[model samples]
Every structure is written in structure tokens, then in C-alpha cells.
Target: MGLRRLAAGLLGAVTATVALAGCTADGRESACDSAGGIVECSPDQRSAAPKITGELLPGGTYDVANQRGQVVVVNFWGSWCAPCRAEADDLENTYQATRASGVTFLGINVQDSRDKAIAFEEGRVSYPSIFDPGSRLALAMDIPPNTIPATVVLDREGRIATVIRAAVKQEGLQPIVERIAAESPEPAGQR
Candidate 1:
């Protein structure tokens, strides 16, 4: 009976491995999965951005909950992800342009060692990134299951307003932030 149980467990593990192996054409986890398959979350369907407090890469602590009353842009990235690398400058540029309008940006570094992630950010990304090697932040936000280089825009009330499942560009991000920032917060009771 024990042998049968062991065999079944092994088969299950193998089956899961095989299933995940084909989850992507390159065998890499898809960005959509990390983002919870949600391309966009409407204002009416918006939920609180997950509470993720963590140590920032270089140093300092960040509490996502404290970012209330501002348009918070949460970006999930990895040091090794090509799209993350490609979109780094665009994010920074947009942040610079939109910050005065009450927009803030936070980055979550996942699936990377601290050293490599820090090295990648050195002189490239100006915004702070939490070292979420296990993707805890992404999971907390309920982003699609396996996507990287995902971006989520949270409204002033810290409610999720949009989710972008791919690399973000300056042109695409700026207007979104501007529009969200321009809107007045929902009434206290409405929120």
C-alpha cells in the first residue's frame, strides 16, 4: 500500500511538471499567469491592492498600504527578464514626468538573487524595488498567475484600476497615470 501511494505521488508530480512544461512555448512561465489572467480591472470591480510590505533593494522599507491617496504603479520584474530590461527606462521616464501629478511607482523584483537584481538596477532604474524573490507581492495583488514584467495601476484609494500583463512603455503608462491622478477620490463611505 505504501509503495502504491509513493507511486501515485511520483506520477502526480511528473504530471504537473509535464503540464507546466508546455505552459509556454519557450518553457518559461507566461507573464499572463503572474497577472491572474486579468488584462484590466474596472473601477467598479477594483479591489484593494494587496498589502505588501518589504525591504527595498538598496535599503529601506516599503508598505504598500501607506501609498493610499495616490496613483500607485506597481511593476513586477526580474533581473533576467528581457522585457523588464527593455522597459526599465520607460518606467523611469514616465515616473519622472508623472510624479508631480501625484503618481508613485514601486517595483517588485522576483525570481532573482539580490546581488543580480541590484546589479541590474544600478544606474538603470531610479524607482525603488522590493526584493520579492518568491513573488509574494505579485501573488498578493492577485496578478495573473505567472506573468513577469506586469504592471498594475492603483487608483487614489489604493484600489486596483488596471493591470497590464506585458512590458510597459512610457507612452502607454503616462496617460493612464495622468487620468487616474486627475480623478478625485471616492467619498469616504463609497470607498
Candidate 2:
């Protein structure tokens, strides 16, 4: 059973890497670089993020399209995941520090009851989260956050810029958020 789990985990990682390669039509090299589980894409290689609209945890509807012209950080998490709980405060701190620079953080709670997810976020994060019990939003992403605690950073133009497939620390995530936020909103000429 343990060996089967290991094999499944490896297969998932390979699949994710292939999916994220983002090769161009002309067969150009992949525009993404994966190092230490963090995948960063060059501005010219990014593709538009899929539309993500969902119900907010407590109330109201949230739409990712409305956040154009801002660097958006989308986190996929579940209340039952230990790593999700461990990174909650760090995610919140990074959001608070980068919001002034046009960065916003959105959480997608997956595979958990509304009550538990809401309880988990009570004092840990100030930003609103979408209730995604079925992971519909995750499936819609260009680079899906397949792992709990994964984070995808969208550039100002709502393009996938970076994906971190592990629980993040404020120190590491804040810099990436700030850098992407500093990029110009003008679309790059190269595809």
C-alpha cells in the first residue's frame, strides 16, 4: 500500500510538470522553470487564466475576472490538511503585506465542510475564500493547484505567473508576490 502511494505521488508530479510545460505552437522551449517544487513562468509564455466564479464561503459571489490589473494569489486548501493549517498565517501575512502593491489573495477551500473551513479561517486570514467543496475552481485553472496548500500567482493581466506546489512561508511567498505586482500591466509583445 505504501509503495502504491509512492508511485501514485510520483506519477502525479510528472503529470503536473508536463501539464505546466507551456510549450509554444512553434515547438519552442518550455517557458516555465521548475525548481524546488516552485514553477515560475516567463511573462511572454503565460496563458490567460480560466474564468473562476464561485460562491464565497459565508455569502456573496466572487469572480477572478473582476481582479484584472492586480496580481492575484489563489491558494487551494482543505481544512483537514495539516499543511494548510500550518501555512494559514504565512499566507495571510503575505497578503497583508502585498495588497498595497495591487496583490490580492483568494483561498479555495476544497473537500471540506463549510463549517470546518470557515472555522479554520476565522482568525487566520482576513481575505475572503471561495467555498469549493467539489474543486471546480481548481479544475478550471491553467495550472491547477492539485495539492493541498498549493498556490498559483496570477499576473496583473490574469495570466499564470507562478505556481508553488507546497506550503509556503511568508518570507518566500512575499517576494514573489511583490515582484509580480511590480510588473507592468501592458501585455508582452511576444506570445
lDDT of 2 at 172: 97
Which candidate leads in lDDT? 2
lDDT of 2 by residue, 93-164 (tens): 999888989899999999999999999999899998999999988776665566788999999998989989
Go through the candidates in order and give each one's C-alpha lDDT: 0.79, 0.86
Candidate 1 structure quality by residue, lDDT tens digits, 1-191: 99999999999999877653335343223332333343554555566666878999988999978877878998899999999999999999999999998889999999999999999999987888999898877766543334788888888888777777778789987887888889877677875
Decoy 1 TM-score against native? 0.79
- On TM-score, the candidate that comes out on top is 2
TM-score of each candidate structure, all chains considered together: 0.79, 0.83
Pairs with backbone N, CA or C atoms under 3 Å apart (clashes), candidate 2: none
Q: How many residue pairs clash in each candidate?
A: 15, 0
TM-score, candidate number 2 = 0.83
Model 2 residue runs over 4 Å out of place are 1-30, 187-191
